[model samples]
Target: MKKVFLIICCAAALFSCRKLDQPNTREFTEEAYWRDAQDALDALTSCYENMSSDFYYFGNEALSDNAYVAGTGFSSVSLVAGGSYDPSNARVTAEWSYRYGAIRKCNIVLENIDKVPSMDETLKRRIIAEARFIRAYSYFELTDWFGDVPFFTTQISVDESKTISRTAQNTVLDFVLQELSEIRGDLPTNVQYAEKDRGRITRGAAIALSAKVQLKRGVWEEVKNECELLINSTENGTYSLLGTYANLFKVANEFNSEVILDLQYGGGRTFSTQRSFLPQTVALLRSVLVPTQDLVDDYIMLNGKAIREAGSGYNENDPYTNRDPRFEATILHHGSTITDFEGQVQTILTQPGSVPATNSVDDQGASPTGYYFQKHYDPTAPNYNSGLNLPIIRYADVLLMYAEAMNELNNLDADIWNKTVRATRVRAKFTDAGATEFPTGASQPQLREIVRRERRAELAFEGVRAFDIRRWKIADVVLNKPVRGIKVSSGAFNKDPNGYIIVEARRFEDPKHYLWPVPTFERDQNQNLGQNPDWQ
Candidate 1:
């Protein structure tokens, strides 16, 4: 079913990538060009156009739950191995190509900015800052995923490209941090240039992204300080935590108060078909992406404790109740009656025989996992369409970053970590009134575990966990172990589908699955390149 949706989305809403073959296209003479504000805006908007790529969102499916680990016929199935990654894979190609495509746009923007003579100096600086932020962002993604990726600044000629060696991760990170820091003062907090200009980079977005980069590299002081600046500042009305967890992903909540940066979509021009994954249509998308039972069990109960914790009783039946409300709201489970943004209850049938009551319902068409994603989907919004903007960074992310940074720095006060976690439950009316006292006496290991668990529970299915596990040095314990998935209690794989609760077994992914190998084409093209340690 998910494959169908991918086909439909790819056909109708394909991403627009920047062309890299030509250094300059449709150029103007020195005497006539650089004399107008619109030209600058047009060029800037052109750079922003890269966000439309499915590459940034759905296309990076292997990074998240979109695909499952099966036999060798599929791409990226080896990510489940959890160890070393061969950089020669096609996934590396996709990452490298798309990033270089973005870098090319940055080169164009940086070189052309000086020519926009008529634009306001401040406005031009902001535009330049925006371009720098994007360039830095692309490089950051590249380095984090494939460490020691080839870093290019100015446009490269065909002959010169072959000689470029991969930059060391530290060197690339230093450059990105430097670039982001230098542009901090020049950018505006938010750009208010009417409708078309709404989604462009603002100061808040830049700092938020910089904070994220810092967090990934384990830069404790910088991460904490940057997050502090953003959370405390109200200069541009650019940051705030939304009242409800649901509101953060609602189709109606585009560019809401909590959003720092989002890949904005609209009615006709640039749009995404992500809404097609809702439980209402999960029957058709039988197995696109299913949440793991591990994730389902991770959400803490309303009492701010894990269900399996001592004294919690860990009731399997009626599990939806008493658990964190965000779990049910985010993942459409059995008996969940989700009303679309327009106030219409969706038909998300869960039982084997319960489906086929509506338009394409039947055992043959039901979700293979009997679950659906309810967030950011609008059933009433035409053909499973919702003008939902996909968030790239949000206030909650910054809060979590701060918590993790402080915890890692070993100077964390209990108040700081607890405040961040409580903020997530604020909309649910959760209070610490009767809960266990904050773990002020806990050791560093204990506190780190708490932060890690908090991130898993809060940011589940946000496409960050698999990579997060890699960075935290716990993938050996977490990923190598096979998790219990729902199955028939009678030991039949195909019979009585709903009778399954679960039992566990050992699941081992290779240790070499951590770093992806540099692509074969890239290595072939540049003799100076070498594959990651174990891959060659």
Candidate 2:
């Protein structure tokens, strides 16, 4: 978010060496490059390089009540979620710059792709559509977090970059939706791609991302229409909830049928986050972000009843048992066992006074919340090698988005619920009919809460919770409460009367917290880049 005058061209090494084992490297410039298809491909490939690190992806969960990151003084998430950060917060700045950096890469490709000599017309159109998809996605993220922001589709001069003012979010939204609509036809369908061409942008990705953007905007009809196109309109390509809930996040199942769009990582690319999430007892890894009990409690019983419900069969002493099947795949609590890369199953004890306590609950540099996240832990990524692909958009999310839209429109009947919620639950391997069946005669309000809760449970810790709460306008209700941890009999942490540990007291100011403050560093460089309200 600085004056980041576009140099426009840098070493091809600045791009990813290999796009998931494909050798792609070439330099591009508006003046010198753009000789052939390879040049356009190389420039476009750079746009895909900014998928971000695993820490940033998972650390975003800390922005909600679902997770907690210990105060690191410089950790932007802890500072912002803790409600003490200002305009200079690094995440604010980094999030802005990184996306704009991506948009810039895409702009280069779109503006110059036509210049390539003798490239296949269809391939060139696909490449253009791919570039536009990335640009649209970046802008969606920017406006999602920043509200209104500087908008551009072409590379700008340093001075132009400095003086351009923030555009209205409505205008940016229109542009994003328009871009996706225009590009969807030009992109290939997911099934149309060859085996080696997997992970590239496709018509399905565009529609999925468009539905998400529409959902955020509360355009229920548009969301339903777009999701229906992907779900029922076979022309877009086939997508379904595939494999078990646990294997969904495993390294071995990176690009399964459930995935619509994913960030590719492999071939010397490092996809490492387990070291910061696992306790030190797990091969000396340490927890920087830990799961809050709030997240754990969101998992309903296997009988489809909440823990506090009349017949959930939930035991406070044995809380992890008889819960949602997804709970075991997602959370690692005290007494949970993890198999090492060497095939050793080690039980991690997070109790207050566990032995060999270096990585136990409440140990220094350990999980402050006494819980760990087990999802997306890549045992195959030994030495942090490329071992996982992060799903940006998946089929489950599409179903949930469609359900939310239908519910909001008062059209969430048994048929829609069966297609979306039931399909998603069945894919997650829910056994009990009560857990998977529709609640007949439910009012719109009840249906709303059910859909929201279903979204939270199904998509937790996948970098979607923060956006969901924000779009639902419930951040004030959720983020303002203290993040609670597990049931602690006695510990350094403050506990409620029921003995659940209070991890941290959180704060969220409505309207102000809804949109983060524009980074002060950006304002410093470009005076036209003014601060958001309540931040000045």
Candidate 3:
């Protein structure tokens, strides 16, 4: 899978038209390519490979998720941290270059699909559908991130890529919806595909992404209806929640009823380690992503009340109890037990006398964020052998998306009854075993809040929170504050072994920070492509 990173680099290179002078057409149109089933399969896989590429997977995930925080000497942390970013520079360049490369791959498969005449009809259609879905998906991502991007359908000859200007965000989004709507039926439903097809795009994935796109465009009715169709399919045994919250993140529990779509990774030598970038890598003796105070405070109590709410049992100073149980499960801190996959607990002693304190982080790294992330940390795997499959789209997110759309559209139908509100209340009670109460009113905003909170608790640290905040127009309230660090005055702090809590004060970025600038190189190369406002 690490080799996929190189392909992504090639794609990035293609975006700048620098690699055009080389023999570029060979990979897209080799002599024997598009002749057989295996060729079609390989081409399809290549199309999907762009997703797992470092440029798309690591770079995109870090920017979208709060895991990467940019700071001085935090050169590697730019992915999540905002400081390392020049809103008008690096991010914009990467967006155009990577998406253009992805589009190229999609075009390669798409244009050649007809050439694979000997392949099975179903196989051929499926591969073509997957390519179209991915092409649309890539455009959706680009439109969301860059606001507007060139909608390239054909394999851009090096010259065209150099001259293409950004398309309007609306046009790109419309094109995404149109393509997804056209190819939705051709894609496979939620049925378990063959081993080779495990992570490929499915009809359900397309529908889910379409609903998300609709939601982003504020097309509440369409979003609500699309999600309802998927969520309500459970009556026919289509999709249902996994039995337990912990089971959702377990490697053995992957692709359960809860997952709509996921970026699957085999732990073979070829595949790169994704878990290494997550919290377990950091908390379990290596450094990776950390949880911020914003996340810590976002967890509402089990009673469906925010910690700041007057009636909730929240103590701002001793802020652990009476809060949501998920807070403990997802965030590792002073007293949380670090359990291995085999269920053996690793002692993380953060109190005085347990471990000697130091002034600076030495060997055992301190948690960059005061709280540690526990979203997908598998205890069974050895610390160095951490290899948990990351879930990109889960059933819980679909449920929340359904609720948000229904609330936005102000729909009170059976779909809403069966899918979002009732389904979520059941899951909420499942999390808090003693809680018997349910949400009473079904007002749009009320349901929206319920879904938002559910997303916060259920999807925390899968790197979705930051995007959710942006889509919901709540980033200013949630992320625009100076983040606090760990305050372990006398105990061993893992990321900071010396028990020294480093409080690096920061200023919240502005509205323009919401959108990244066109990379300097892209701006320099393409005169028609202008920088995002305030990027210069």
Tens digit of per-residue lDDT, candidate 3, span 335-363: 66665445666545333444432112222
| lDDT per residue (tens digit) for residues 234-299 in model 1 | 764457678888777766666677777776555443433453345434324333344545667777
Q: Please give the range of 10 consecutive residues that has the lowest summed lDDT in model 1.
A: 1-10
| Tens-place lDDT digits, model 2, residues 238-352 | 8878868888888788778889988777765565666777776664655777889988888889877888879889998889998888888888888888886667897878888
* Count of steric clashes across candidates, in order: 18, 0, 19
* TM-score, structure 1 vs. true: 0.83
TM-score of each: 0.83, 0.95, 0.82
Best by TM-score: 2
Q: After superposition, how far is residue 142 of candidate 2 from its true place, in Å?
A: 0.4
**Local error of candidate 1 at residue 291 (angstroms):** 0.9
State in Å the error of residue 91, model 1. Answer: 3.0
Q: Cα deviation of 407 in candidate 1 (Å)?
A: 1.7
